[model samples]
Target: MRKVLESLQRGAHAGLVLDRFGPLAPTDEKNLPERKDRHLTAVLEAAGSGATRELYALAFERRRSTSDPELSRSFQRSVDGAMVIGLGIASTLEAGLRLHQTYGVPFVPGSSIKGLAAHWCHRVLGDDRGGEHREAPLWRKEGDYHRFLFGTTEACGAIVFEDAWPIPNSIAGANGGLRREVMTPHHLDWQGGKGAPTDFDSPTPVGFLSMVGRYDFRITWNGPPAESATIAGWLDRAAEIVSCALVDWGIGAKTSSGFGRMVEAETGNRANAIATVAVAPVGNRADKRSSGTPARVTLVAARPKGGFDVQEEGRALGTLTLGTSPAGLSPEIGMTVDVQVHNDDPVKPQYKWPVASKPAKSVPPSKRR
Candidate 1:
């Protein structure tokens, strides 16, 4: 097997090599440390060729042309730190990295990109329902903007998030976008719940693969032409939100430990922001009054600093901060109340509840008891 692998020329499929050709220890012998290292090196080297670059180019062209030219947008960005994706995937080496199935290249999955964007939109942007089970407030309504961008359980979304592929020869090494990484587990006994960790225990160093370098991210509008203008506006907002999510919240596996963070490329130029069309406020006619529109908002979640995160008609209206509420009025989660909404500045709207307004009887099932 080793000789057959060695005879294979450059540009062989990396996924095939890693998955099938990986060296394994004999039944009698437990570990062959050097053999595993050599196998990983082979996989990395297989991805570092002009053939992989050409394959990625073809894939990128197909993805870009999947939607209309006018409705699609693409941008370049670089991973800020090591990105470990699909680490839990079963493999002989114990850790695994997601690679392109056919081309054997490192690429970010489209589902991952959309998932991160949706999470950022709900959590950071305040489009939440304030419950353990119902975190996606925007997905509740069929016509909600969030639902339009990122579909509901019933229908598909209007926009398509494409996988991000690495730029040709972006990194200095021969491994292309692939990087070797290691994780040392120190407290084996304590983790197994057998005994307390001691200094005398030996640490096991596990090897894995990660990714770094620039990648092209693309998003396209896939809705009807009649709704193109409105969908385009939402797509513009989504692109910005996705960028913020990648930089702030990160993506892929092990984000809390600083994996999968990305930032815009420092090329001093950016793709033109998607053109936005003016959209009429969506909701009841009475909610659009001139003086100050009255709205029934739900207390989604409490802010860490002060005040509550409120949502109206399944749309996030930003944070509602109040120094003090009227007497006999105590704010609670899942409670709905009437508030006056001022949209003079459409970008950032203001919310004000009258002193007469009181909490409505819309408490969540858990809160009722």
Candidate 2:
């Protein structure tokens, strides 16, 4: 990992198209001195890349699409309902060493969400048997409803918990957005070695990560043929537990030092935020999907931030996240590229296209370049 970061730094120096930069949290605790500074700087630099920004923008757009009132209605068969749960991670939140492998963005994993849910359910809900039953086999071939909902070794759960991510435009640092944080751990030798450098040991700064922002957390229900009333009740209880767990119990690393504590965003609570959308039924759902049919499009503009504006004929279409087009698309404004409409929210619509045919022999290499 260190080698990878070093290579990217070299690429940036050589004017190469460096992939996005992100704070790659260090795993070796011994080398703690420069971890914080290096991480924050790298992430800021990476986030500035047009390619990186484009990915975030597109992701945000897709998220918005899922939440759109009218558009979401189309997927009524495959989807159950969705809730926008917002959370604020305290400055001390240590998301560990993981970042989105592709985007480099920090996120709370779905596993953590599952854990948070289970913790709230068994502990807060006052399960008399306690978490001890967690290991016990549900054993029923039909599966325990609670076990089926949350999942156990015997079966997968009915719900899909997505990673909680930073909302697009929300990761910005300067204008009251994300703030870099410092973690200084004292008595490193004792802590690091489990003995040794005692009170006399020097303290070291661990890392600096962005702590600001109320991230959106989305949960989707993919189900069994349960009664609507039963499913609705379960969803209600689950959302409540998750909300309480995040606020009351907190999340991520370092809650005791005041890290990972977050409150719900003002938009709405789970009950109001919840929206039912049917998952498109199996048959002609593919026909209804935008990607099923591809259309040829022309490039209108190359966004400075690593994406291209597209048009079909003279009509404006939308933005294509960088690298979505083939190298043949070139930097020219009028180049044609085949594309498929990407499903989007009522807000911003976009499309993605296959790599263009090899650059025409008539075009100069410089033009292609």
Whole-model Cα lDDT per candidate? 0.66, 0.48
- lDDT of each residue in 1-369, candidate 1, tens digit only: 845755565346777767777775545445577677777888888766545577667776776667665687777888876898778887767788888887787888999999988776666554333553232443334324566577667556667898888776674358868888888999988999999999988998877889988888888876444233444555666677677777777789989888988877885233332122122232213323343666666664455567755555534334566435556788886577767665522322446665465767787888876
Poorest stretch of ten by lDDT in candidate 2: 71-80
TM-score list, all predictions: 0.66, 0.50
For model 2, the local distance difference test gives 0.48
RMSD of each predicted structure: 13.5, 21.5
Positional deviation of residue 186's Cα in model 1 after best superposition, in angstroms: 1.0
lDDT, residue 27, model 2:
72
Show the colliding residue pairs in model 1. none
lDDT of 2 by residue, 241-319 (tens): 5666666656765566666655556633333221221111111122233552475555544554577655443222346
